[model samples]
Structure formats: C-alpha cells, structure tokens
Target: MGMMDTLDEWHSIYIKAGIALPGALLSARFRDEGSDEQKMGLLLATALACLLACAAAQNNNPTENLALRGRATQSSTYYNYVFGYLASAINAIDGNMDSNFYHGSCSFTNNDMSPWWRVDLLKSHKISQIVVTNRGDCCGNLIDGAQILVGDSLENNGNNNPSCSEINYLPNGGTQTFECNGMAGRYVNIIIPGKETYLTLCEVQVFGVPVSKKPPCS
Candidate 1:
C-alpha cells in the first residue's frame, strides 16, 4: 500500500479514541472567524496530529505505555499543501549525522516556463543536505538544473530570503541530490530553472537528526 493509505489507516485507529487534540479541535472551532494567531495555532496542532498519526501507524506498540503515546513520529507521505501547481513532501531519514533539511517538488506549466520552487524554514537550522528527485515518469518534462540558498534570510526578509550560496546544476534529469558541508541558517530556498512539466514531484526526501539541527520549537 502507499504511504498515504498507511497514514489514513493509522489516523482511523488513534485519532478517534478520545484523545483530545487541542490544536485540531481549536482550529475547527474558529476556522472561519479566527485571527492569524488562531489559524497558526490551529495549523501547528494539525501538523502535530499528522505527525502523531503517522507515528502510531509506524510503531506497532501504541498501547505499550504513556511515554510511547506522547512521543512525536515522522512520515514520508507527500501531501500537496503548498500554494503552487506542484506538490511538496516532508520526509525524515535515519543516520548518524545531526542537521536540518527541507525538500520541495515543483510542477511545470506553460505560463511559467522557468519554474522556480522556493520556501523558507523561518527559523534557525543546521542544514547539511538537500535532494531534488525527478519523478517525471515519462509524463512531465525532466528537471535538469537546480540551486539551493542558505543564509540568515532570503531577500532581506524573514519570510523567503535565503541567499543562493550553493548550487547543483544538472542539465539532464534522471535523479539529483545535493549535500552541503554543514551550513547554519534560518531559511532554505530551492530554484528550478527548466521546462514546465505536469505533476513532476512524486516524492522528496529530507534527512536530519533533531539533536543539533532542531526543528522550529515554540
């Protein structure tokens, strides 16, 4: 079965068992009339539930103990939550290294011939690696060129300003992966300059440990 199917099965098992998700509940409460603060809080809660639902399914011992119940879990499911014509992925990898990472998949269109995909983590992270997978599958155009930006911020703003200090140029697309040598920053930007392909991202893989490269904690 697909990763999404696995997530759905897990959601059914752990979500409706009277476990009160404050974030999800609150989001639903004021979904329409809530302020930006409310919406953000709701989104964080939803992200948490998503992570937990994924964790419960991956773990075979959800009923083991309370410690197991409160722990956070990660998933490789590619949910298209971005505001573009492409889908994005949030994946976790296992290894001995500690770092921060982000991955995005972009789809091409006739209007935007030069497709560029970008996002900022908005917080500090020791990003050490990045990967741009080509899931063309013989349907969309292959991505042949790519670049990564790492710095204090992108475009002098905390929103999307990460300077493109490192680049990985691939003129022909099969599969491409880029690894940086331990750079610390608050934003990560990916730009793809190539043909516009339809539904190009199948999956994106981001690998990092939480100890040194901490995810945004509030």
Candidate 2:
C-alpha cells in the first residue's frame, strides 16, 4: 500500500479511539497491512517524529551569516581599489584594516553627497538582524549617522526602505548588529544622509530565512 493510505488508516484508528488529528487533515492513499497493535505503534512513532522534527526546526535559527551568497555594491566607487572592494566586502577576508582597503578585504565608497552601500540577496527574506563591521583605521567615524534600511524596493538605492537602525557611533574596528525583528526585504542598505562622506565596511553579515507566502500546511 502507499504511504498516504497507511497514514489514513492510522488516522482512522486514532480517531475511533478519540486520540487522533482531525479527519479533515487525512488524505487517503496508503493502506496498512500490519496487525492493529503494530499499526498503532508505527503511527505513534510517526507522530512523535513529527513533533520532534518541528521542535528541531524551531531550534535551528539562522546562526550562520546568510549574506555570503549575496552580491554587494555601493552608490559610487572610489576607483582606487581595482580589487572590487565594494563587491567583495560582503564576505571579505580578514585584514589589518589600516592597509588592506585596496585589496577587497574592505569596501570604500566615494565622498558622494549621500554615500550608500547595498547588498542584493536575490530573493526576499524575513530578516532577523544584520551585523556590520567598521574599518579599524582612521576614518571609521564617517559611517556615523548612517541609516540601515530593509525593504523590497530599489528606489533611491533602497534608501526608501523602512529604517531598522540609525548608527550614531562605531568605535574603530568595531562591529555592531541591528535587530530587524523579522522585517521582510530583499535589499539591505546603509547610507549617511545630508553630507558627503566615505562609507567603508569591513564586512556585512545578514541573518534570516527565506520569505514565503504559502500556507504552512502545504
């Protein structure tokens, strides 16, 4: 018999004993050929497994950074770094921070009127939080007043997205994480408004799961 048929038979048995899930959830396909007691034991095991699976999934939060798979860019490049520092900084290798700005181990944007940097995750996600690393060298303070934005829109270089945090200060070589609280977005942006300044980043790490609209029952 098919798996679904067996599941349905077990469902029926549980229902008759007043201990089963609702009948509407059962889809007939599998058939059970084992003895009734064996069937009950198997069903009980399956139910326990399902419950354990759900608990495990809940515990498997996004501990590892999810931005390593994404692409990075800034509003404007400094043209001094041929190694694509802005593009490689999302998951850049460690650097001394003082001398590695041109090697793609960090990102540097030009002194534009509103310097910005962004990451394209390629798909929407329920963003939980973002960790941003600042350059350890002399000018890390340039990122002050930067706004962290998260949303699906690309307008204004994603600056139009809802703000998750406004960075006031970051010590040299400091790392700060802003909790987004499950904000939905595909783009993550950082910008300093109303003035020209450099936006250098040592690393950007995003944590979250893929966004879905489908029903959980499916």
Top TM-score hit: 2
At residue 212, candidate 1 shows an lDDT of 48
Evaluated against the true structure, the overall lDDT of model 1 is 0.39
lDDT of 2: 0.71
Instruction: Give the per-residue lDDT digits (tens) of candidate 2, residues 85-173.
Output: 34334433232233335445777777788888888888998888898888775677887999999999999879899998888998778
TM-score of each: 0.37, 0.70
14: Cα error in model 1, Å: 31
The predictions' CA RMSDs to the true structure, in order, are 18.8, 8.1
Please provide, for model 1 over 1-218, each residue's C-alpha lDDT reduced to its tens digit, 9 standing for 90 to 100: 54334434434544543234553453353425668886666556656766665554433222211111111111112244463322322221111111211233333323344344433343454544555445433432434344455556545222244443333333223445556444665544444445443223332333222224222221
Instruction: Show where candidate 2 strays beyond 4 Å.
Output: 1-39, 56-60, 81-103, 213-218
